[model samples]
Target: MSDQRSVTRSDLVAYCDAMLESSAFQDYCPNGLQVEGRNQVRRLITGVTASQALVDAAIEQGADMLLVHHGYFWKGEAAPLTGIKKKRLKALLENDISLLAYHLPLDVHAEVGNNVQLARLLGWQIRGGLEPANPRSVGLHGELETAQSGAEVAASLERALGRMPLHIAGNDRPIKRIAWCTGAAQGYIEKAIALGMDAFVTGEISEPTVHSARENRIHFFAAGHHATERYGVQALGERLAAHFGIEHRFVDIDNPV
Candidate 1:
């Protein structure tokens, strides 16, 4: 730790807000300090994505602050806070719970980002972002330290994450080059296919993604978004806990992918 005074929850939020440049992007939902609760937070709760279940658990646990990788207010979602959205917000507000959300920022954070963490866990070395134009591209492409067969890679994913990946083998080729984007990034399968990757991995899958994988001759793996995303938030939360000497618990609400 630095010689400076220990940072508070607000200080952490401020640091994250500044680092993410939250205000620069037109976000669907409010970023940083969504629901205000205790002025000083001592215990932190983290989860893969902020679903209603997560909110309820945090409230039940009496968490001082809640951190999540996915949160409310996504692009193209209805702006009106009327139905489920209203209910979710009301739950937080009623409990006076503080909500901290990090999305793309956390995904591309180099060290603690979801992609980086996944790569490390799977023994892949990231080369660069899939999209070169955007510096903060959420999708990452990389290669394994040593090539493994498709089935072998599947075993690695299953063993590491406890979720058997839905592997769509495009070829009998040994797996070497792989592209990954955690959390509902099936849209990028074609991009991975274009990159000549032996396989593409993501947290979730869509109907068309399967066909695309077959047609493009790129292996596809749906590794469960919740499973893939659990790493980054937990890493970040642990860091914050150590930095502030606060209790941190990563709450997992399993979602079958």
Candidate 2:
């Protein structure tokens, strides 16, 4: 069913790992080629997470590999394959579908990174990293081409990401400077505040983040984690497909959280 040509699995994995610079960052899970399937891949599927639903979808699509931002084997998770994890792995293995994942490395990529892709979709101008001293800073600070109210910014995010972001207004003034990190990066609000950003945007929120936003007088937006991270893997997949002349499809398994 795939119209695209096939490429060796090793070449595809090597190219992705090198492009993402997976070795540069210490991450919770392995960066690339988490599981091996066929020696050659013709059709590839990309998603935000490798959940059971996503695995099932990939199998249905006849995907040779399932590439994602979040995959199995986290730092503290039990080693045994059981419960939901067991089912997910079983589906992939039985279907002969490879699983490839990248965590912080995918976050820090300048071109196809989640933060950069979000900015591209939302039209934010990138100025620099949240932690400028660290080469692989996960968060970024930037400016809006034109100043807009907190409410207006929220609207833009809702339109672009197709999800209503939880906005916490800290001030009445218009917002020009902003900082953002995708996927459960609410903790980086402090870094944004230290940079004197007018607002901070990230996926997922904690109770303390509200107090910090109110006290620090910076607007906060908790966009859904799955929504924020959806773009990077898609972008990476598209790029790989273009480079290798292989079929690529981004199957979005919606996650409200």
The prediction achieving the highest TM-score against the true structure is: 2
lDDT tens digits by residue: candidate 2, 69-172: 99989999899888898888888888889999999988989999998999999999999999989988999989999999999999999998899999999988
Candidate 2, RMSD to the unseen true structure: 1.0
What TM-score does each of the candidates earn? Answer: 0.90, 0.98
**Candidate 1: misplaced stretches above 4 Å?**
1-7, 24-28
Instruction: Give candidate 2's TM-score.
Output: 0.98
Instruction: Write candidate 1's Cα lDDT for 1-257 as tens digits.
Output: 24423346678798777766766655556667766776777668999877899999998888778898888777787789998889888998888778899887787777788999999988888998888677777889999989999899999999999989999887788988989999889998878877788999998989888788888888899999888988988888888877777778999998886
Cα displacement (angstroms), candidate 2, residue 157, comes to 0.4
Error of 1 at 168 (Å): 0.9
